[model samples]
Target chain A: MGTFLIVDDDESLHKVLVRVLKLEGHKVVGSVYNGSEAVEFIRNSKTKPDIILMDHRMPVMDGTTATREILALDSTQRILFISADETAESEALKAGAVGFLLKPIRSADLFRAVKSCLGEK
Target chain B: MDPMQIAWHLMEGTNDIITSINKDGTFSYVNRALMEKLHYSESEIDTLSIGTIFFPGEQKKIKAIVTKDTHEIISDVQTIMVTKEGEMLHVEGAFSPFFEGGKKVSTIALFRDISKQKKMEEDLERERNQTEFLIDIMTHDLANIHQEIISMLDFLILNEDLPNETVGIIKEGISEIERATRLISSVRKISIVSKALPDLQCMDISLALLRGAIQARLAFPEKTLKLVTDVEHGEYFVVADEYLVDIFYSLLHNSLKHSKKKDVTI
Candidate 1:
């Protein structure tokens, strides 16, 4: 089991991801509306999560910035950026994100991606 | 010139039908042209009040005219009027006031039959509405079908192991779905282009192409693919919709599907 943080502006999509991940036996650490908030939550929290599912387009600060900051804080941080933005995958890669998932994401794809990020088979 | 003779000459020369009415609603005079158009006799016109000639519930309109400040009222107003043979003529008219030295004298109404024009306008409106409805259905319904086909292909790729022949058939189905989706996209593009120029944003084209290639690769793992970025760093930017990058992704997928050898370049 892995602890994951979901960062997305869409509440419906966040709920869906949480439900899917929980069903797959992953513990959801928390969820926030944007990248900046995700950064703040990670800073204050005593426990670091196994994975972060971040969205690209956010109101204040984007997934790329958050990923860069998180990795700066700890280079070994595992982060996956999820976005409807078609340009997300490479951007996430450049920012040192582990992987990228597209929006309207399938449950199976999400499972595979989360497992991949967590270094699980 | 006498008042009646002047009125007669005015009506005879103009295309419009003219009639004069007293404040009491009695017809003081109707020109010969008007009499011929209505097929009414001089004696009959003289016996009827101007209000009696109007179709039912037209007294309110006549009252409006009497109370109006303008000396001339030219309106595309619709109302029915009674002919000598008791036929109802759908008419649109201009009603004007006649005055003698600042004292109210009469009301002169000029009218034309407009039933044919009204019918044509209604038919044109209906056709316009139907065309819009059809376009809406085509955009939404076809898009849904395209999405469903893509989803089914994804499901098949993930869960099922099939023979080479079955895989070939699935690839063919994907091609068909791609064709249909392309057609819908072209229609949507035409509409957007016809309206106003789209506001383009500067984007990294090479990165977009790479992401699209990666997505295509993930979608079709069986196909061997090679992507080379010929674009220079930061120089790869172009002005276009960020979402429009999907077009390149679709094109790459199509190219990969048809490549003879295992290796394909985008």
Candidate 2:
């Protein structure tokens, strides 16, 4: 199990993801609405999450930009992008995301990706 | 004035560039409009050949029109012309051979400038491309919203305490969301097809039919389907894209869904 931070514009998604991640025995460190808040959380929070679930399109800022900023803040932080836009995959990966998951992702796939980030089977 | 002079006067008054090419390829006559558009005077035109008036890039096509062995009328031939200052002008025209005593003596051609229309078409194409890019962005956002709804619904369905009826309702809503996603995908495909020609290749249509039937079977597991086709005996090859399978799938799926009986034949 690993600690996680959720960054997405959708509040309902945060609720479900928090519950789901808790059910899998992972710690929900924090949740932020956009890339700017995510970067702020990473900077000010006492506990660093093992993985950050990043979303691409948001009002204040976008995931790829945040990914670069967060990695610059803490090179050890692992970011995984979940987005509906497949076109952003290359940019996200190039900006230092661990993985890119297309939206409408099944819970099974989501769990697998999180587990893989922890070097688990 | 004679009838010939009257015809000459009529040709001279028009904005269209008109010219006659002799058997030896030299210009025998050029209307006033032709001389003005080409920046050539009456005396200068006598020294010019038919080939010199056409843009260098259009020389090959012009050669075909002028060197034909038989007397034929060529209409709506769009070509580029070069003025004396070496500027290119786009024009469309018809060319007809003038036969004297059953022998082709010269060719009379008429051309009208269409550069402005071509530029407008190019601008419209650019606007269309921009619209497509915007549509793609919208589609991505819509898909994200759909994904959020689906994830929430899936979480709700996981609750063991919920009644079977409520679970069934939630499941139905999820299915509807899936249908909406498919509709978006179809619209995007249609937009793409409208913009460019589809890449076509020879494909075995029988395989596509079989795949479609398999898809339909998976889609409607409750319905018993009997697909009868003569595709097995021969190779049914056609030039088409991957959507051919979707076409067959839609037809069979619709037929199966609408049929009242449990068993369907198609």
Candidate 3:
């Protein structure tokens, strides 16, 4: 079982992702509401998660900025960008995200993304 | 040099009523124009105080100008003054300090009736305020109904698991409502924003464009689509609102739905 952090502004989408990931037997470290909180949590954590599922658009700070800051803190952080907006995929890739998942994300697609980021088949 | 000669010259030459008051407020000089306008003789004018000719509220402002130690000028002050017949007239005036050598002597005020202009300005201001109030009520209050309808449709799309036919009907209904709402909202927003437009914040434009393309793909899953992104390595920021990105997403969704080709590029 791998630990993962889910960050998104939408509460409903966050809850859905948490439920689905939990059902997949992954240990959910935490779920946060915005990119800034995700950065703060990652910076202050004693142990980093195996993977991070990040949303692109949020208030205060966005996923791209959070990704850059988090990677600055720990270069080995594995990030997967998940958003409803598809245009963020390449930018997320440039920001060092291993995978990109669009909104209304299927369970299979999400599982595959998380697995891909974890370097498992 | 003579008081009567000075008074006669003033009355014959100008329409203005020339008057002088002593330090005790008794009238010292009154022109023929003054007597004709007020129907008061020179003797009657001398017996009356300067304060007696002022309207109740005008006394305060007049007193302030009169009692100042140094030379002072009051310009275009609008206030009411009373005639000898006790009729109130709205007037605008300039009050200047009169000086003898280095000492303050008296205050001389020249005034004109401005009741017509004052009434016109008040009417114009009232109309302007009423128009603004009506517009605010329509946009802020009535526009919320459209927003609520959009929110409800979003909820339905996210939560409801209906048959394909029912989903199609609901989606069509949502599209029609959105179209009508956009038209009304745009008109209202244009009027409101024209009055006061907010500053835009810098945003990542490429990210928004990419998100718009992805949302289009999701909206039409049956269509084979290719979203070609050409975002540079460095930061690509532009000034815009995030809500506009969602509008672009909606436009792309419409394009994808209507496209006849097997492969559509965004």
Better of 1 and 3 by DockQ: 1
For the predicted complex of model 1, DockQ is: 0.04
- TM-scores, all models, native as reference: 0.44, 0.56, 0.41
Candidate 3 residue spans exceeding 4 A from truth: A1-121, B1-50, B82-88, B151-266
Chain A TM-score by candidate, in order: 0.93, 0.96, 0.93
Task: Tell me the lDDT of model 1 at A82.
Answer: 67
Q: Write the per-residue lDDT of candidate 1 for residues B3-89, one digit (tens) a residue.
A: 999856777776556677677777777767567767778778777775667776776777667556566665676777777777766
The full ranking of all candidates by lDDT, starting with the best, is 2, 1, 3
Better of 1 and 2 by TM-score: 2
DockQ of each: 0.04, 0.36, 0.03
- Model 2 residue A112 lDDT score: 88
Which model is ahead, 1 or 2, in terms of lDDT?
A: 2
Those runs of model 1 whose alpha carbons end farther than 4 Å from true positions after fitting are: A1-121, B1-10, B13-15, B32-39, B47-50, B55-58, B69-90, B133-150, B160-266
DockQ of 2: 0.36
Give the lowest summed-lDDT range of ten residues in model 1 chain B.
B139-148
Q: Look at candidate 1 and give me any clashing residue pairs.
A: none
Q: In candidate 3, residue B217 scores what lDDT?
A: 67
Give the CAPRI rating of model 2: acceptable
